[model samples]
Target: MELTLPKKLNASQPITLETKGLVVIGVNGAGKSSFGKCLLDQYGSLAKKISGIHALFINNNVEEPISEEENEFSRLQSMITERLFMPRLSEYEKLILHLQSEEFEAAVNYKEACKVNPDLLPPVTKIDRIQSIWEKIFPHNRLVRKSGFIELASGSRDSDSYKAERMSDGEKLVFYLIGAVLCTPLNSLLIIEEPETLLHNSIKNLLWDEIEAMRPDCTYVYLTHDIDFAASRPDSKRIWIRSYDADTRIWDYELIESNESFPEEVYMEILGSRKPILFIEGTDTNSIDSRLYPLIFPDYMVKPMGGCQKVIETTKAFGQLKDFHNLESKGIVDRDRRTQGEITYLREQHIFVPNVAEVENLLMLEEVIKTVAHRLMKDPENVFNQVKENVIKLFEKDLESQVILHAKHLVRKKLETTVDRKITTVEQLAEHVEGIQQNIHVQDIYTNIKNEFSLYVETGDYKNILRVYNQKGMLPQSRLCNICGISNKESYLNLIISILKENKEDADAIRSAIKESLGI
Candidate 1:
């Protein structure tokens, strides 16, 4: 399973191609396709093992066998072209005739092969497998066979299904992939480059699932820069190929151990460039980290990750990548309810925790809130104090809900723990109860529960709860946005950005603070 790659393209470690599969992820030009070809080269020919309409071919044209020296782009370009130039139904007429005459059983198998998971779509016959995939891609439609051609139509068979040549690029790509999978023999290696190419994001997962059904026996190696798609397949081992040297002269690769998802552009920026990355916990869509961090540390590429743990995990994971040993990576996360010691542990690992409870809390600072209100043309005179008063009122109301919620959560958690302990003790007692007449340590389960409840009641302090709530004034991000009438984090940041545009002095202050904090 340990496959050593070529010396020029030095692998920092031997690749373990586990029976499950290998997923190759890299920035563009990081040699995802080249690595796949190298794997194909190392594994030798699939000619004897593979069958069907030629898994490696483009259309009916037999592709030039892969050469060791060929670059990734050339191979991908050929594949894309072949996928586009797939034959019409008329072209398959002769094959259909031959199947009907001599290879009837093979035809039957091909038909059955086309039939996929019922959840994929309504069931279709064998020849309609390609149609099934196509319809799924562009639904409420049907692909019907007519005189020597397949027509795409809206629902009814009376409407003509368009010819293959007339199909949309996505449809063409889907059909080609379906054919490639169905035609290929099980247990053969299928190398697909950027299956996301020309395909919509919505259909990406479904397409993979359908193809997987066609050839569960086939080992798939997907070469992609898509972090989301790659991360979605936790079943597969992900290999991240990156540049090793400072000048981007040498390329290196490593396997990502954790399920850390990053944007494709972030990978490109990290691997090839010298800029230090500011990794934050959350996706770009929802995280203010992407918007605010870039403004503060313009020199760094502010990349958003999945969550707090993911931020820490990725930082540690990347540190261990021998190829990227010199890669400067840092992580930032919300303080949340983490203790100072917990924050210190993360900081030691180069993960930064904001002083505020959360990133949203930072934006709600008096200056920040005032600036946002002024920019939105609110009463600038007492905006800060007005907002503070409103926020406090909101906080008091929120506390009412929080107290009940927290109390319920605590009671439930304690009850569950007590039940678990009781279950264990009773099971042990049952095991030995038959032999022993009396057990000195044994207490009635109901009595134990009553004692635990008394202890829980003694621990409850309303004064301490009130003091904590008042000290934090913690408004959930969603609740804060609701009060502001802001739909989301992005909108809130956008308002801040608008404010900064008009107030140069305030912007300068923010910049100064950023530079001071970063020691720039």
Candidate 2:
């Protein structure tokens, strides 16, 4: 059956959902639960809602068996108050009644067939089906059906059995889920809110896989904030709920589509962000770019996309997605030996190339150094000057090698673009290679880079040196931390971050200096 999404979710067009199911994911306060409630209301009798935080208490009171009518009524009422009341107890009772009825029918059928063929196997009841899955999830525990009640039995010993009500929260939750799913009406839409709640990572996927297999006729819609859980269901269509306007009862959301440029996890992270995305270069959260860029660009959500190429590719790919026009995206990659023409080209493509060779060098910026020094109550000018002298001295010591590396990088970048992929024949390839060999002047490139490097050192232009230098150890080597009375590079970085969070003026000054160097 096709389910059209609520109009407020996407007023521009109707989004139809297929029987394959859809996973609605978003950050907390994004109204995912509200969206689930809307679906329940829309589908009415065709849908059944299962809360993630269902009351796991199984009321094991030995009382009169509830009539079918009373059972149905209790189940319906529990659906509305399931978040608090012991709703699953009603379903557990229903499961027990269904199992007993099945057993009686099987016994009657067996008696009649005894004369013909007494070797027929007993039919599997709903509880038996649930037990099969339960055993797999909890290897040490077994489901025991005794005296018309389901109880948990420790391995190999019925004497160790305990009432279902006494089961641990996790165990009780699992049983409740199994019973609820088994008791659900045929072909109903099962809307599970935060299915990952109280579920261990190792078994969460397995439990859902088994449960879905048991009810192949039902369409499953999972509303959750857990990206990993959402990602585990590969076939489900993923929708990111951006926000909800309670006053207008409208939701701002987007469907997350698979892209060749990004993995599912990275794509979800990007789509899940509430702020405009700024893709930066870093491998992980511990990287300088990941930690520093977020504080510096407080207005945008800074995502570390590992290497420079990935950042550039992801940004361009994101921009091309016309559906995501509501979210603006940009990328920042290190300058690292890029010529002015290449830098200008990248800028035009919305990829900002900073004047600093790499992000680590940003810490060595003259203004940033002074900001930290002043914050520590040191002489900003003196500290900056000493740091500047140390950095220049270090750069001079490695001047020749730096020039060689820069020239090599530029040559490699140039040659990488010169290869003609369109050339098909060996003859054409030979001519292309010959043309590159004849025109390329390695000595000229080296001499030009060396001259530029010498000029920066001679002028003692701290900013330009940072722009051209690609030293990861520059900050520690300059002893700027020592000059400011900070213990080390890591501590110094932490201090900068703390200052940015607590001191607005210092943050703005640092931000301005970095932005100026980036020409942003």
Candidate 3:
């Protein structure tokens, strides 16, 4: 069942969550669980416990309700070891709270004491009283022999026992998730942070599907940096967060449009640079994509690939000028999720631009270039010049032209959006002004990107598209030069043909290089 969020929640972009599930992902100190508590309190205390916390976590505090400072306090758990232990202790106390309050007073018979008994039972004075209190407070906890709560095993000797805290961290995390789920009603809201942490890789993938299948009435959310997690859900609404530096404060958040397709780009933007891209959907795939690209092209920047679909996304977002390219794992790719209506909206708004595969596709092209270069190396000037000329002519406008056109489109969009802002008050008008400034900043960035990369981009379109050199040598034995119609008098094609004709010893080297370049 859909737990419809308040109108204020809807004020942000209407993220389409088909099920009740939601995920919040960040580094250890990003306050993911705290955000969940705020959600629970706002909605009425659904999840009563957190599974695994890195440090001090405070919640359900009797005095001050959660506020910015409290959130900040909890966010520092990763920084301080003592802080991380807060959640576990807090949970232990909540579970045993009945031992102190209700039972003690009831056993002493507070009201009866004023009349007949005069004293509340000081502590667990009697075993029978202890058993009675445990039953009342932890009724759902199910004690077989009345000592501790039951942990149901799939198949056992019909026993009631708990190995709860004694399990591994990953197992405890699973229990924590289950406890969090149990605290809420069957039809309640549930949000989890990166639930995959401490989890085994074999189990990581199956976890979400298992969760989604159970209890159709429950709503859920999952925030993750894991590409498999992101790409796993076809229905997930990707919210790409980009940090913008503002003069007034420090970092700010903005969304990158169509982010699910470019997990690497979004990941790098959120995570600082220098961290290698390690995780991608279906990482073990074709050798060309996962292995060769990373090994041979060590000089090029390689991020973990997120299926074939992200290849297109990586290209469009980063404009494909960067040194690295994506390797397409043929088996797994994501399909774009635009309804006919949304596609129509984009076209009418002039948002349609040719999709160029900047990531994986370009990687293939680079391999082709290396192949061409090695094949002509022996012939020197004549063969190299010819190949270079053809490459230059072929890619003259493809990259540069596309980039410039998109820059103009962004400029037009920035203008249109500012004009559409609703300015009902001076403060609202000031916000519009601020928005305009950001738009202008984006415009400047676009312009600068266009200026810096235009030359290489323009020449790359045809030149960059690589093919296996069928001529074997730079020139074919059968065909005359298309430009000069010469079979003998010569061109770089002839030079390459001459080199190949004489060299039988280099065949093994050439073949190996081809495999390397093609990432076969």
Candidate 3 lDDT over residue span 239-351, tens digit each? 32222223322212222233444453354343433233322233564433354334432333455455544444444444432223232211112212222353354334322
lDDT of 2 by residue, 279-323 (tens): 999878988888888888888989888889999898888778747
**Regions of model 1 farther than 4 Å from truth:** 1-16, 40-44, 47-129, 132-139, 244-251, 259-275, 279-291, 301-325, 335-346, 356-361, 364-494, 499-505, 514-520
For candidate 1, give the lDDT of residue 64.
68
Least lDDT summed over 10 consecutive residues: which range in candidate 3? Answer: 328-337
lDDT of 1: 0.58
Q: Number of the top candidate by lDDT? A: 2
Write the residue-wise lDDT of candidate 1 on 1-520 in tens digits: 2334422336455445555456777777777666676667767765122222232233445446788989999988976885679643432343344323433555455567668633443334455666667677678777766544566678775765566567665665666676656655557777777767767788887788777766677777777777667865656666677643435434476655543444333454466455777787778654566667777666676777777877887777665653543667888876554545677888787887665544655565655655555555665446555555555554455554444443454444444444323435766756555534233223343344334433333554222222223233343322444555667656777766654455476675655544343224
- lDDT against the true structure, per candidate, is 0.58, 0.82, 0.42
Give candidate 2's root-mean-square deviation (CA, Å): 6.0
Q: Where does candidate 2 stray beyond 4 Å? A: 1-17, 26-45, 55-120, 153-159, 241-254, 262-272, 322-325
Q: Give the range where candidate 2 is weakest over 10 consecutive residues by summed lDDT.
A: 54-63
- Against the correct fold, how does model 3 do in TM-score? 0.38
- Number of backbone clashes in candidate 1: 6
Q: After superposition, how far is residue 313 of candidate 1 from its true place, in Å?
A: 5.7
Tell me, by TM-score, which candidate is best.
2
